[model samples]
Target: MNKDQVKGRIEEAKGKMKEVAGKVSGDKKLEREGKIQNISGKVQAGIGDLKEDIKDAI
Candidate 1:
């Protein structure tokens, strides 16, 4: 996978960890931040996937 995909996946993992930690610690703000980060990572990964698809199609 491309750099974006790799990075995004890493971010997604990190966000998930943060979300879990936040829940366990009872931090709503951290939980929300983690959710946002997770979403952002998914978007980045999707963009990377689209780029790869286009490249392969060519």
Candidate 2:
């Protein structure tokens, strides 16, 4: 996978961890932050996927 894909996956994992931790600790702020991070990661990964697809097509 490309750098963006790899990094996005890592970031998504970290966000998941943060989200769970926040839930366990009753921290709304942390949970929200994690949610945002997770979405960002997904978007990044999608971009990477598109890039790969285009490269292959060419």
Candidate 3:
């Protein structure tokens, strides 16, 4: 995959870890931050996918 895809996947994994850690520590803010990061990662990955698709189409 491209840089964006790789980065996004990494962020997603990190976010998941943070989310779990937050839950264990009972930190609402951390949990919310993790959730937001995870969603942002997903969006980045989607953008990467779209780029790949367009490249292939052309």
Candidate 4:
């Protein structure tokens, strides 16, 4: 995958960890941040997939 995809995956994983940690520690802010990070990662990954699709079509 391209850089965006790779980075997005990493961010998604990190976000998951953060969310779990926050839940264990009772920190709503961290949990919210994690949710945001996960969303951003998904968006980035979608962009990467689109890029690949376009390349293949061409």
What are the per-model C-alpha RMSD values against the true structure? Answer: 0.6, 0.6, 0.7, 0.6
Which stretches of candidate 2 lie above 4 Å from their native place?
none
The residue pairs that clash in candidate 2, if any, are none
Per-residue accuracy of model 1 over 1-58 as CA lDDT, tens digit each: 8988998898898888889889999999999889988888898899889889998999
Runs in model 4 lying further than 4 Å from the true structure: none
Give the per-residue lDDT of model 3 (tens digit) for 1-58.
Answer: 7888998988898888888889999999999889988989998988999889999999
Model 3 residue runs over 4 Å out of place are none
Candidate 1 backbone collisions, by pair: none
In angstroms, the error of model 4 at 25 is 0.8
The models' CA-based lDDT, in order, is 0.89, 0.90, 0.89, 0.89
Off by over 4 Å in 1: none
Question: CA lDDT of 34 in candidate 4?
Answer: 92
lDDT of 4 by residue, 1-58 (tens): 7888898888898898889989999999999999899889989988998898888899
TM-score of each: 0.95, 0.95, 0.94, 0.94
